[model samples]
Target: MYYNCGVGGYISGIAKDKKTKLTTAMATIGGAGLDWHDVKSYLRPNGLLSYSTLNDGSNKLIFNNYPGGKVFDAVVLQDNSQGPIHPELKKFFEKYAAIHSKDIRATGAEPVFLMTWAYADRPEMTKQLADATIKVANDNKAMVIPVGLAFANALKDRPDLKMTVADNRHPTAAGSYLEGAVIYAALTHSSPEGANFLGGCEKPLAQKDAQFLQSIAWKTVKDFYGWK
Candidate 1:
């Protein structure tokens, strides 16, 4: 289960196409301003691991409408970009995260939190969001993907990289690719440094740039988890 906004959509796009160590079957339900509250509405009434589709013509990827009573191994939860950091929304973010973590555990699936990046223009948000996300994940004893940390590391290493669209919030192709790579590294506990998936970017990334993003992703994940 992958649920959130455009970031989750882009990650699902990579999972749908990328050939990695893990064979993934992802169901992505996304829309703008999608928070945990919105996710709660879509939870299966039967208390299954599946969710009803919220197809408002905004979702980039929608797969496996019904899990057919099949349980998911893990469910990725991403709140709105500001949900973790915003004062008013942060409470709901924490509350629903706890609720959903327990709900997901009840379904025999681990709850994984997707730590999203801050808006491109607001670089300071990186640490703020990371802190908030880590707190919640620690509270639930859940896994944190650390995608936000990957984004911050990428920008710090290469300030010239165009990570976001003109809106400075939505990710560009390169940014999306980085997100996927970080996720891959975190989930598989392996480096994505040499995998040849370009994340379906409109224009293929240069080999050098792709490798750079992959390295950054692997490094970030390794550091976040204190992995060797």
Candidate 2:
């Protein structure tokens, strides 16, 4: 099974980009519960499958929401935090280990990947999040992906590259393209095809023509999944 889950606010951006048509069927499907633990009983009996989501926040937020649940895998994340790892976060993961230990003893094996996506406030901040993420992942034996750092590397040379700033933080059209690449990278563990996706949005300076950003956007997703 393929389970998609995340906080409502984070998934809204993806729905807007991937299925802009608000009335479409997809608008309602393909996401997991924001608080996975809260819905554990509903998910446990379902069995093994692929999972994805932007379920990032305080560990307590996750713990309170999820109690003794297991995922085949996960990409836990939090938005921008300018400082070093928040003390609360460290505490939460420690507690997560305790809860997970109990769950693992009962349930066998499950994989977890701790992730974070946020623009760093300064150059050194990336290192801080990296170190913190590594430490937590080590303690919990979870995979770690520092998406914000990855974006910084991807965009370093392309100064023109920028996230679409709608209400200031949410991705714009171009921003969504960047986000797609990030997600692609997270899934594939590779430098995903980034430029190809952005090409669809270029404004035609000449003849009267039509362009559809969604086509490129969707292709990016398809190609990343090796579906086309």
Candidate 3:
């Protein structure tokens, strides 16, 4: 199950680049503006199979009322863009993350957190979100996909790249591509440097840009986990 806000959908196309077989049963409304608390409500014990279709800006799949008795290898969880760092919402983020982790474990699946980036104009939000997410992930013994760190790293290297749209919160196609790369690395522990998925951008990403993002994503993941 991919429980998300907006960015989680991008993983489908990116996963395809790495030749990762990913089948997502997404629980979200319109694919945006949802917090961890809202996700917990949708995943209540009695409504485990209740999910909506997911349009990852590439493919759209409808899995509502997904067939019962199915098991997933991992479930990715992403909170609202600011839930992890906002003063008022931080507590709820921690609380629901723990709750969701326990519930996901009970189903015998690993719970992976998708660490999100900050608003485009707020560069500092990257570290704040990462710190909060890492703390909770450690507490729950869950894995964290460090997309936020990758975003910061990429911007630090190439400040010219536009990672967000006009709203400064939602991801642009390039940002989404970077996210997909990070998720691929985190899940497989392999570099996405040579994969061919250019993402679902209206105009496919230039090979050089894609390669750069892939490199940044892999490096950030390795650094975050201290992997050689």
Candidate 4:
């Protein structure tokens, strides 16, 4: 079920790179929901299948069974919480962890938790978020992809990169690329320094900035997994 899981962050980046020459549907379709309830629904019966938008800007979000049930290798779960560490973050993670163990595991699929970043300006929240993520992973015995710490580490030496958007909450193009690199290292346990990528971005990223992001991602992964 590659659709629902596995390889954490790098799947899209690597998948896209592998098919760079392909035309049309070479992109990975990202499926997500408004909140935990919405996100969890996708794993159940009558979940999201597909949708479309018209030239008139009309669109619909459909929910139904996708083809080839229970065929995915693993299911990757992530908390979509925004802003500086929320007060109820722990509860939120615990609930997701429970869902992964009960529902995902029932399908013989391994659950993965994608540790995400905090708002760039709220630097202090990064460690807290990472800690909470680790706790959830340990509790559920799931793998934790520490992309947040990678972002924080890169910011220490490269704040000018402006990884997040103007609101400092969402990731910019370069930011998402760096995240994919971090996920690649976590999954492959191999250095991403040699990999050149500008993931899912329209405008070209500077070579120097891209290289630095890759290096930082590699460093963070190695440290997090004690890969020394």
Best by TM-score: 3
CA lDDT, every model vs. true structure: 0.72, 0.38, 0.75, 0.62
Tens-digit lDDT track of model 1 for 40-156: 334454433333444587654434444444356677788878888888888888888888888777756688998999898888999999999999999999999999889899999
Per-model TM-score, in order, reads: 0.77, 0.47, 0.80, 0.72
User: Best lDDT goes to which candidate?
Assistant: 3
Give a tens-digit lDDT track for model 2, residues 101-144.
Answer: 34543444443333443442345555666676666557766555
Model 4, position 160: C-alpha lDDT score: 79
Provide the RMSD of all predictions against the true structure, rounded to 1 decimal: 5.7, 11.7, 4.8, 7.0
Better of 2 and 4 by TM-score: 4
Ranking by lDDT: 3, 1, 4, 2
Q: Which stretches of candidate 1 lie over 4 Å from their true place?
A: 1-70
TM-score of 2: 0.47
Candidates sorted by TM-score, best first: 3, 1, 4, 2
What would the per-residue lDDT of candidate 4 be over residues 1-228, giving only the tens digit for each residue?
022122223345543454432111111234322133443445544443333234365564444344655423455566553411466555555765776566767655577777888776777778887887778778888888888898888888987788777877667767777776776667656666755555433444677877788889888988888888
